[model samples]
Target: MSLIHALVAQGSTIMAEHQAGKRDFSQATQTILSKIPPNNSKLTYVWEQYLFHYISEGGFTYLVMADDSAGRRMPFTFLGELQRKFIASPTASSSTTSLAPHALQSTFGPVISQLMYTYNTSPPTDDLARAQSELAQVKDIMVQNVEQILSRGERIELLVDKTDTMASQATAFRRGARTVRRQMWWKNKRVLALGIIVALVIVWIIMAQFCGAALRCGSN
Candidate 1:
């Protein structure tokens, strides 16, 4: 059971989905679907002997259940191909917000099943698969522990708070620097003005003394 199940959903709502192999994966699938973040993300979850890999983008999630031996690259590559097919399908035209549970089962379910089989039977050396695998590698999908995923929201909030505090501190620093610059500029301007006034006064006194306030020295 290398590729056991695959699902395409909008948030927690199942749009189109399919499963292969003898194992009943509904319970595990539901749990994973419900917990997947709505934001754009790529992550892998380990549950027992199986691995759940998913990509969430544009409010839609493409997820796969595979045997632990399947490795990361192939499962992600399958998801990449699945996404391309889903986008080209007519069902993709429907509004995501209005989609109900299993809304696209009749239209897109077979597509998922066919894809699951292809990846399960074929090797990953094909050109398309190789290209897709490289794309997944570039994404650097996160491998998440169950405990870590549960606590991620809290950690993100804490990080946001720290960022806000740093931004405010930076703003305050810039304002203080500007205020100091303005004060120094005014201080220098005042000193220059005072020096000019004093120089003018000294020059007037010298002229008065030398020229005799009322009459010129040369005339006397």
Candidate 2:
């Protein structure tokens, strides 16, 4: 099975176990965490790992840590990391062929709505203004598309055409966001490179002038 399918399956099992008051949540959490890259610096993993340990040990310190840090930071980072990993990994296009439109709509619809609402109500900060604006626009467009489909209230075949449409939109959003980040990175690199080159040139000119003065003095 694909990684996504495996994750979905594990998630469903974990939910079931949690509802039944079983002790499998820790195992399931560990399994999921193992799949993520070790280099991931997101604090969500620390939070989840702490929660898992807390549940297993029933220790007060684990609970305290969870309450103090994990509870506040994990949910958003966890969801964001899942989204990023899902987009970055390769998937069987055929598997996505079976996904229902309403399923897609139901899954992402509320998320997009929440983002839209958040962007509109939140004041722009100096660092996040561009990101906020871009996210707002993307959410607006996604909301319109999802609403249009939901309005039709009819089942559409998970055809290539529909899949392509959704995939293209997702790809475009990811590409555009990454493009902005890459441009900023390259801009900084260019500035640093130019500064280094200029400094080297100045040093060479100063050394040449010094050598010329030394030669003239020695001859005189």
Candidate 3:
């Protein structure tokens, strides 16, 4: 079995989540609520490789979905660690209401990320027999989704270049717009005024002639 997703949520609202596998589990997260246990429990479908394990406390729930081979106890162990962190940290604990994803991430993301790093790197020391040994087997078969995971210095440089190019283009666009507005004002001011005056004069003369013709017709 291969691990898939780590999630923190309350009721239907998601707090934070991380994915490890290549498969798109977005639908799973969206639909998994119907099957969510009211308390601490594991949801396992016989046909599905991924299992959902969740624990509810203080109106918050920590959930983790992993390969069925990941075993029930291991995910809970990870979830337990998450629970402790969530309680101890000011991030979610500080919020009196439903935790916002951004706030949760800003405060709890680093810890959750570190937890993922540790679990991915090595099994928890507490459950060596049940967790680490089995996890190692899954790790051997699981291929890293480098696209979603890896960020070297080169990627950061590329991002900086892209941001710079976009900024330059934006500056150039503003400059061009200002130049066009200024040129339109300076170049066309006198010509525009003259054209408007000429058009008005012509209209006035036409109207006067029409009135004169009407008066002549009536008098004759």
Top lDDT hit: 1
Q: List model 2 lDDT by residue over 1-220, tens digit each.
A: 0011112111112211111122223433434333323232222223212322111111101111222232322323223333443344343122243343233333433443343234234523442544445444542211011111122323221212345679999999999999999999999999999999999999999999999999999999
lDDT of 1: 0.79
Tens-digit per-residue lDDT, 1-220, candidate 1: 6888899988888888888977666766677777776689888987656788999999899999888898887888889889999999888978445688898999899999988888888845784568665765575587754432224232211112334679999999999999999999999999999999999999999987876845764566
**TM-score of each candidate?**
0.62, 0.25, 0.51
| TM-score-better candidate, 1 vs 3 | 1
Summing lDDT over every window of 10 consecutive residues in candidate 2, give the lowest-scoring window. 55-64
Show pairs that collide, candidate 1: none
In order of TM-score, best first, we have 1, 3, 2
Best by TM-score: 1
Clashing pairs in 2: none
- What is the alpha-carbon lDDT for the whole of candidate 3? 0.63
For candidate 2, the lDDT comes to: 0.35
Error of 1 at 212 (Å): 62
Lowest summed lDDT across 10 adjacent residues in model 3 is found at 152-161
Q: Flag the better candidate by TM-score, 1 or 2.
A: 1
Ranking 2 against 3 by TM-score, winner:
3
User: Root-mean-square deviation of each candidate, in angstroms?
Assistant: 7.3, 21.6, 15.8
lDDT of 1 at 29: 69
Pairs clashing within candidate 3: none
